[model samples]
Target chain A: MTSSLVLGLELAYWQQSILRSLGILLAVLLPAGTFVYLFLFKMVSFMQSRLGPMEAGPFGSMQLLAEVGKWIQKEDIIPEKADRLLFKIAPYLVVSTVLLTYIVVPFGPDMIFANHDTGIFFALAVSSISTLGVLAAGWASANKFSLMGGLRAAGQLIAYELPLILAVVGVVIQAGTMNMSGIVAAQANGEIFGFDGIGSPYFITQFLGFVIFMIAVQAELAQTPFDMPIAESELVTGYLTEYSGIRFLLFFIGEFAAVGAFGAIAATLFMGGWAVPAAWADLNNNIFNLLGPLILMAKMTLVGGFIFFIRFTMPRFREDQLQKLAWTVLIPLSLVNILATTILKVAF
Target chain B: MSEFLRDYLTVAIFAAVAIGLLLVVLALGKLIRPVRPQADKYLTYESGVDAVGTAWDQTPVRYYVFALLFVLFDVEAVFIFPWAIQLETYGWFGAIEMSVFIVILALGLLYAWRKKVLQWL
Candidate 1:
């Protein structure tokens, strides 16, 4: 987990390639495996209020495969008179936008592609693009319910986006940099302009920023208490009503990937991103260095688990309630966070 | 190997991996749902009532006003962006050019507003 050893630059390109490929290969496999094991088998069974996947691979692991097979065997049906082009393109649009946000996410200090300065802003901008696709799918299906769902998604995306961007700006103002790495760096060494620990972990200086960031992100993900976009009972799975076969699958995968990405970003920005927890900080440098990325993963899982807990504990909010929460509560709170951060920046 | 071959090989590898991942994801998803075959199953469900023909039929005429207004403002803003970006360099000359353009746009909006055409159900 030491940043230097993590890259293994001393190794030949081919050796490095071998390790990189192996790492990504395993990275791809582990989560996908857990997704299949956890949600597909365990959760679905839990959903039915029954013991699940008990007979197959350990704890019904193979049941995910079986379920996948069943979804495949179903007919690929395009609704009669649906707008063929938009209907076909919408799922791709949604998934591609979600995947694009991954470019700046730091899995470890060395584990990112181009860190688009204003990485936070770049993400917020791109995340909003999915609403267009959802809108197209909803309107193209020509289904009233689907259109309403899509419209809801678009409105929710539009409204929450303001507060979400404002919240990120609050953090950016506190750190005085849009570069995520720089923001995290500002948090390091635990001192801000002679104020001990003010320049420390972002969550410390901009705790309000951190709080708003989490809320806005959860809303952006359309998670519990904020998932007005795809309220099934209200919108019949919303813009997704017309999709079948692979297209439908892409939407969910995009959704789950989004959940993971939000957790990663929150971990990176507010959770000290791979920084060893304080108790472990007292250990040897050699030990702490190796433990950082691992600790980051633990942090990510903790945030991810919070998402699952939220989903389980809350019910879908009424559409009006969702709007009111965003406009009244989240917006004012986010604005206050930004104002406070700005004042601190100027004062400092 | 030739450069052409290298280029083609790289493109092929990229395409293959991306396509492969997409296909596997979709394939796995398709394997998960229950498939029952019936005429009703094939039909679009509308609260158990038969869909009156297809679902993707025409919407009300009111949306046209919204669409037209969106296009008008969107184009106006779009045209202004280039001018706005270069406003400092162009100074008075650019400001005059933009004001004339906006005046013409304002007239159109005023005309539309007077006609009560902007309102939609």
Candidate 2:
């Protein structure tokens, strides 16, 4: 019996090491592929009233693959006057931020890579680094449009970032914890608006914050309705105007991946990551350990789809209009949300 | 490794690997892609105007005022977060203090508005 127990412990150790490696790999690579189709081709095409990528794989699933192939064959161009070093490194910097964010994402109750005490803050701080990368791309491109686009991105991101972080502060205050899993657990136990049966998701209690967070995230991602930074009509894809081939592809991947990352974070914060309702508590069995990510993905898809819906349906905001919304509207509303959440928490 | 270092190490590793993967994919693209740079193609695009003078000319962009304002409010926003995390512990005292803080900032915003600093010409 003792020998068998030792063998079991030995196996468990190896299994854990293997799982750690796999988790890191998935966190880094999966976001790049998971939503490429939904966000890139289908959603946009549907809004424009056409079949997207009908000729590629089954239901055009392979369309992205075909496009990647085509992009690879295209020439990598560098404008003669462009700053070569920054131009090359800018896209990578953005990618680095997106990847680092996954480390703290709580995929399940126990399925997080790192449940740092500063989880939400860590994600927010890392995401801000991408703005610097964007500014670098614009400065290095040596083009008027690129320069304008870069400055616009910097301003928009900085403005929207406030509301985004503040909105989460509501949820963070409610949960009374900064760790990602702790936030989820709080939601799982929470009741919505004092309703006994209704499971608490911050989406209901923090509705104002939710709306503001979603809007701010949309702007932060540079999607439609807030895409002044890359306004093709005015800026010709903005900071991306000078890039071609694989460099352009890097930016594309980073953007779509960011959409997924933000979706994941929002779902974790507002929708209650990996939490089933109390009524269905029995369903939260050992199987949840396996399906936890799937639950998170389902929530993420809903959040991301809402974002894409807004992106495709809404008109782009002008540069000044975008700044005004972030500063005058979102900032004030989020502050009010914090004040309200504080009073409510203190009273009840 | 300690849990703290391990967590951060994973983050660093994830970043390195992600950048590396992109580099490999781009490298693969470079291997098969053709490179033909013509003189015209090298010129910066300026709506087909044969690219006039350099693109570095200075123009009036009035948004910098708002940019400074953003810095002020953003710093204020940051201060609210830590206070928010410890809010319940501090109770009503914290609440009243934060209200006064926000009221002061709101006045700053009001001043800026009256001065028309927020107007995007």
User: Which predicted model would earn the best TM-score?
Assistant: 2
Model 1, A1-348: lDDT tens digits are 112344435564334434543444345335544654675456656866889778767777787666555556666767766778888778777766665555555554555444555566666656778778888888888777787777777656755665666567666655556666665555554465566533367776678877777777777778877777778777777778767766776676677767666776788778767553333344225554456556656766677667766675688887656655665566557655644554455444
The candidate that achieves the highest lDDT relative to the unseen native structure: 2
Q: Candidate 2's C-alpha lDDT? A: 0.82
- Number of the top-ranking candidate, with DockQ as the measure: 2
lDDT of 1 at A79: 71
**Model 2 chain B weakest lDDT span, ten residues long:** B9-18
Evaluating just chain A, the predictions reach TM-scores of 0.82, 0.91
Q: Candidate 1, which segments miss by more than 4 Å at Cα?
A: A1-53, A192-199, A277-293, B1-20, B23-42, B53-121
